[model samples]
Target: MEVSKRFEQAINKLYNAFHNDTLHPECCKQCAVGNILDGKDSWKHLSDNHGATTLNYLGQVHQNLGRTFNGYSPIELLHIEATFLKGCGYIIPLHHKNKRPKHVTDKDVLFLGLTAVVSYLCELDKRHDVMDCTTLFNYCNVIKQVSLLS
Candidate 1:
């Protein structure tokens, strides 16, 4: 599938999941990273061993992009994204036992969209060696500033 279309599908899936109360932000975090590594949503696959595997997978992605992980593992990336969501005024429920916030905002949507795009690119690059991340990075940069209505 085209990257743009895949990204759109991911964003829509995430939106529906969030709106339907079927997925929490914490699970979404893992799903974002997992999708990139496993080519599908693997939120339920997170475990102690899976955490290490995710870090290794992200390292491989960075290598493929001619970049370095630079001490930032997938877990850290997830935390950073979660922090970004919090900064945008969304409450992040830290524990799975806690209920997710009832509201989502434009910022939340954009943040999740960017996450999906990044994850999708990681998976894409694994299959297509010549894929250029610059275009996707630019797309994400634009998304960061866009204001979409919930």
Candidate 2:
């Protein structure tokens, strides 16, 4: 049940953001990767578009160098951002007229993003999603816990 320091810190920040009303899908500094990186918006420079999964030239250079921000590679950060935005109901590569949640202030929308981000994080670490209810089945011996790389 060991988790990497990076994963633990990222989960804690994400949990706090969800509870503190600070998880905003559109804001570079308040988004999933932002909070994961301790509220820094510099990661936005890694991509041309906010919700784009592809990296820009700078991002490619960093990735090639094996540079990591808050323990996440540049490409992982992009995927995390894209996951959050999509979960929050934004069309990919966000634009002013992009389809989005009707109510940006809705907590439900943010919750969706949080869940998606958590799943991604767990997968990144090759661990079972801690929030998954299927673990209850494992306890009952009805099925195995869905751990990653099992």
Candidate 3:
């Protein structure tokens, strides 16, 4: 398979594996951290509790395929992930500090928002229901290809 097609297939497999509710929540966390840590017990509890699903799902997309901020408190890790998701066009930029909800830091909200976006995209892909979807992925490919030409 071509590289792009292979990437799409892997993403689809990850979506299926992640959405399988039969899987334990903690198991999802373990999948997210993968070999990034020696064991599940090594992951920060807060990150596992809050951002595991998103990290687990997206971590499968890139190499190193593990929780990037597993060493930090959940809040810190969440913030870092949120900033990354926003950079990826998954959520609005975390520019307004004052408007954030209580009990939910900017990072937490961003992570949740990212989860929704990813889930929606995965579902749309499954159903063959697409609208604005192709543009984003195509745009990314274009940028990558263009950079090579320059």
What 10-residue stretch in candidate 2 is worst by lDDT? 140-149
For TM-score, the strongest prediction is 2
lDDT by residue for model 3 over 1-150, one digit each (tens)? 122342254345334434542212223233322212322433434333333223333333331433333233333344433432342333222334323344332444434433544444344345442334657678878888999999
Model 1 ranges with Cα > 4 A deviation: 1-3, 28-58, 61-150
Rank the candidate models, highest lDDT first.
2, 1, 3
Candidate 3's TM-score: 0.23
Itemize residue pairs with steric clashes in candidate 3: none
RMSD, every candidate, angstroms? 11.2, 5.3, 12.4
Candidate 3's displacement at residue 99, Å, is: 19
Cα-based lDDT for every prediction? 0.42, 0.90, 0.37
Clashes of 2: 0
Per-candidate clash tally: 0, 0, 0
